[model samples]
Target: MGQSTTPVLDRVGFAMLSIIMISVLVTASSVFGTSSNPKGVSIPLQERGSPLAKDGVIIPEALARLAYWDAAKQHAKINNSGPPNNSSSLFRRHSAPLESKLDDILWVGEIEIGKPRQRFRVDFDTGSSDTWVFSSTCVAPICSSKNKYIASESSTSTLQVGEFKKDYFDGTEVSGPIYADTITVAGLSAEGQWFSPIDQVNNMEDYGRDGLMGLSFMSISQLKAPTFIGTLLSQKKISKHIFSMRLSSGSGSELFIGGINPSKYRGELTYVPLESQTMWIVKGSASANGRNGFNGNMVIDSGTWV
Candidate 1:
C-alpha cells in the first residue's frame, strides 16, 4: 500500500505545482510575459531544498518571502575568503556587511540622500543602470511631497547632465537630470554613486517605495565604478569562487559573499569565465567534433537571469 501523506509533504506538492505552472505560463515566446513590468518578477525558487525533493519544495508566496527575509538577517560579508580576518590591508577589511542589515534589503524602503533628502522606493529596479527618485519639479513623490527630496540645494558639486523626458519599463516617463550625488545604503556610502535630481510625479504610486537602487552589476561611470560584487572584491576581500544569493519573499535577501551553505542550492551552477571589466561570463564549448565556439564577446553579469 502507498504511504500516507503528511501535511508538510502535501504543502510541498502544492508549491512545486504552482512554480512549474507559472514557468510554463511565462515560457511562451509569443505570449511571453513582460518581465520588464512590475508583475514580471521571476517565480521564486524553492525555499530550502531542491524543487524535486519530496519534502523540500516550497510553493507558497508567504513561505518564499519568509525565506528571503530569513536569509538576509543571516547575512555576512566577503573578506579574503581564504583566511582569518585580515583588515590590515585595503581589501581584507571585514565588517558585518550592511547586506545583512534591514536597510540594505529594499523590496520597498526609504533612501535619503542630498541636503533636502529625497525619499521613495516604489518603482525600484535592479535591471537599470541608473538610480533616480522624484523631486518637487518631479510630478512624483520624491519631490514636493511633505516627505523629502534630496536637497541638491546643499551639495558642493552637482551635474545636471543626464535628463530624461522618456518613459522607462516601469511606466513612469519622468523628467530629470542625471547628476553625481553621494549615496548611502544601510550606512555604507558611495562618494559618486550616480543619482538624479528631479521631482516626483503626482499620479505615480507604487505598492509604495522610497527609491530604487541598481543591482544589475553594470558600471555607469566613465571611470568604470565598482559593482555591488566588485566593491566587495576590491583589494583583499573574499577568496571564494562563488557566493550564494537568496532573495526571500519580503523586501530582504542575502548575498552570502564567500559562500552560501551548500544545503541551499539545488541544480548545477554554470560558472561563466570572469572578464575583468566584462563581469561574469563564460564561453560555451563547441560540439564534440565541431569547431571552437564563437570567438565573440560575452560579458558576464550576475543580475542576468538568462
Candidate 2:
C-alpha cells in the first residue's frame, strides 16, 4: 500500500483538518477489481503527521474544506455509492475537543473506563468498527509505553474468551481477548460496553496513540459487539445517530456526539444518508476542477488519512 498525507473533513463541513498519512481503506464495490487487496480492507490506518498544506499555494482553511469532501468521495468510491446528500435541517449538536496532543496527524481523545474511571488516550477512528486497548496483562513492548486497562479492578468488568484481531492495510495487527466494561466519553457513559484488551501487537509504531476507539457500526466489528457510539445511541445516551469532529492545527480538536456545533462551521450543514449500515457511507460525486468527475459511494472514515 502507498502512503499519502492530506487533510480532510466530515460531510457536514466540520472544520477539522485531519492530516492523514498511511494506507487507504478499500470498499467492497471498489473501482478497482476485487482480489483481497489490502486497500480493500475496511479498517483505517492511524496516519503519520504532516502539515495541513504543502509549499505555499493552498491555504489551510480552504484546503481543509476541500479535503473533507475529497475524503468523502474516496469513501463513496470505496463503498461504490453516490455523492453525499445535503443535510441542512438536522441541527441538534454537542461538542468536545480532540485533546492531549498537538501537531499530530491523528486526533487523540480521552475516555474513561471501569468503575473508578481509568482514563486512556484513544484514536477515534471512523473507518473501522472495534475498540481495542492495551491491557495490563500485555507484556508487549508497545504496551509498556501506554496506559493499560485492568479488567479485574473494575467492579463491572466481565471477561470473555473470544479472540479479537484486526489487521490494517499497513500490516499493523492487534489481537487479544475481549472484555465488557463501562466506558465514558465526553461525559456520556455506557454500561457493560464490549471492547478488546490487546495482548499482542505488530507494527505498533504505525499507531501513535494508546488505543483505538472505532466509531463505525457493529457489523464490521470482529467481536460483533456494538461500538461505543452505537451503545450510546441504543441506551439513549445520545439522542441523534450522528457525531461531528473538528481537528485543528493547535493543541487540540473537537468531537461532537449526537449533533453539530453551529459555531464551528459557517455555511449550511450538508447532509448525506448512509448507504450502508456497516460504515458511514455517503453518496457524492468527485473530481478535480474542470476534470471529469466520477460518481460513487465513499466512507466518512476518521481513521483513514486522505
Candidate 3:
C-alpha cells in the first residue's frame, strides 16, 4: 500500500503528519491502529529505565526484559557477522536513549559519529538546518562542559574546507569548521555526512547538550549540506523520505526516522501543505472554547516548549 498523511491525538492539539524533512509530533491516548509500510526506523527519544522508576514510575518487567533480550540478540548477530560491512549493517542497539531529566523541556538523544563511534548527546531541533557539535579545539567554559568531537581522531572523518556559522532564533550563535563524517543514529548510519565542530558559541553557556541535530530542510542550511534525514534518504538507509516524532511527558517519547509507528496513533491523517520548505511551517485555523478564532502560520518546533 502507498503512504498516507495521518494525525494523532495527544496532550496537545491535533498535529498533522507529513513525509520527507517534515515530521509529525503526536501522542496517542487511545487504542492503537495499523499504519502503512515505509515504516522506517524508530529511535527512542528517552531512556527506557527512568531514574524515577522506583518513585511510582513503573516500567513493566516484561518490557524491560524484552529490551535486554533484543540487545543481546543484536550483539550476538554482530559477533557472528564479523567486522562491520556497510553503514546499514552496523550493530544496532535495541533502544537509543535520549537522556532527559524528568519533566525537563529539553529532549536530548544520543548519536554516534566517526568510525569507532564517538557518542554525543544532541538536541534534535527542527527549527534549524545544520548539525553542530563542540570541537576539540573549543576550550571555553561551555564547550568544556560538553562532549567535544575530535575530528582528527576519527579515521572516517574527512575535513571539508568551509566555515559553518548559524544564528538561532533564541539569540545564540555557533561558529565552526565544516567536516564530512559518518553519523550513526539508532543503528542506522548516514556516511559522508556534513556537520560542524563548533569552536565558538555565544549566549549558550548554560546549554547542556553536546550538540544540536537539525531536522529542517537544506534550503536554509548554512553548511549547504543535506539534513540528516535527506542524507539517509539519499543513501537508501531508510526506504521512505518521511519521519515521525512521538514526544511524551515521560520516557515514552520516540523519533521514528522513516515512517509512522502504526501502533502509536489512530484516525486518518490530515495533510497540510507547508507554507515553505525551509521549515515545517503550515497555515491553519483553530477554535477554542466555542470561539472560532486563531489562524496563521504555525511553526512546529520540537526543540522548544509551549
Off by over 4 Å in 1: 1-106, 115-124, 140-147, 164-166, 200-205, 217-245, 250-306
lDDT tens digits, residue span 48-92, model 1: 111111233343643443334222211211110222232212111
Better of 1 and 3 by lDDT: 3
Q: CA shift at 14, candidate 3, in angstroms?
A: 12
Give the better candidate number (2 or 3) by TM-score.
3
Please provide TM-scores, in order, for all candidate models, with all chains considered together.
0.42, 0.68, 0.71
- Model 3 Cα lDDT, one tens digit per residue, 82-118: 2223232222212212454432344568899998899
Where model 3 places Cα greater than 4 Å from the true spot, the runs are: 1-38, 47-103
The 0-to-1 C-alpha lDDT of every candidate, in the order given, reads 0.32, 0.57, 0.61
Q: lDDT winner between 2 and 3, please give it.
A: 3
Error of 2 at 190 (Å): 0.5
Candidate 2 per-residue C-alpha lDDT over 137-194 given as tens digits, one digit per residue, 9 for 90 to 100 = 8887868888999888899899876799875543366899988889988778878788
Descending-TM-score candidate ranking: 3, 2, 1
Which one wins by lDDT: 1 or 2? 2
